[model samples]
Target: MRHARPLPTYLVQRYHGWKATAYHENKAWYRRLAKEGQHPRAMVISCCDSRVHVTSIFGADQGEFFIHRNIANLVPPHKPDGDLHGTSAALEYAVNVLKVAHIVVMGHSNCGGVKGCYDMCSGHAPELEEQASYVGRWMDLLRPGYERTAEIADPAERTRAMERQAVLVSLENLMTFPFVREAVEGEVMTLHGLWNDIGEGDLECYDPAKGDFVRV
Candidate 1:
């Protein structure tokens, strides 16, 4: 069976997504919804991967969960975004404007973005041409975790360790935003850290019980 050149998964998913929209009477739905208003209950910080879809995984509909997606599903501390911060902007909207009740930072297994972090840590990206201006420097944020786990000799175990640390770091970054801090302090919002193991088709929630992620 021949497939399209390069087989871009997003292209296929987009075609099917459009076809599935036949049942959606989307004629001016956004305009009508604008009149109705929106108040989503959850805000999901997720990866920009074609396979990791929070809406589908959570079985949510439009206006159900507001979403923010970026490379690695990362949350950087609230710095004056002199650059476009799609995730931070969306987070501000959800936590401040929409006042969502829950914020879920979802990291996933076998993530290429997380792999990039690993590759960088391995000292494999020595060429300056490999990064955009200051991106290489900013990527240093991940160094602490990688160095702490350097004693773990097994490659697979090291990767998993790094990925989990990324989730925890991102969860902590959420608190850097004042709105998020206020919401949590006022009991208006709760934070959750989740890991989606694509290989096992399982969702793991961070459990304080064992101080690690547990299937939920």
Candidate 2:
């Protein structure tokens, strides 16, 4: 711990500014949140990409949303093998413990995780094909999406398709959990898929009936 470097001056200054402004402005709300444990109505699973600001996009206040972020915002199929499953653990807590009425898997444009999967699957990144590549292995969950999008002739369009695929895949995998299935079937919980176009500041929601993402 002693070897850890001191916080950067710029980050420290920014934190102080935020603490003085936003923290001061919402002092009473913050205290209330601290006294009463969070009871968020929704849980959002989103990408770790720096550009994707889930709270900012949704204008969410503190403790309004219980969020979990990982590369590509993926959710693996339910596997009760007692292994280390960070996403699954978050899902379990959100659905069972928090009892959030809604679960949203939100993906974004130009995601590095999705791009890396495309490169590896398209033979553009041979190094990623190695056994030791953690990213490559994690992205294997998106391979089915890649396969479905590979036939597209337009590179840009294919990438967009893959991005949406990430959302669809997560939605499908979410149902693999028995609790999730029960909640959804009993109308106790609802699942949603969303994609954000960072550049254009556009949002899209998946329409299961049309099997495509519709701009919102």
Give the top-scoring candidate (lDDT): 2
For each candidate, what TM-score against the reference? 0.81, 0.96
lDDT of 2 by residue, 63-163 (tens): 98999999999999999994439999999999999999999999999999999999899899988899888888889899999998867988778977999
- Per-residue lDDT for 165 in model 1? 72
Measured by TM-score, the strongest candidate is 2
Q: lDDT tens string, model 1, 83-192? A: 54666789888987898999998988987766667777787656422656354444455566678789999877887877777778888888888889998999989999
List where candidate 2 sits over 4 angstroms from the true fold.
Answer: 82-84
lDDT of each: 0.79, 0.94
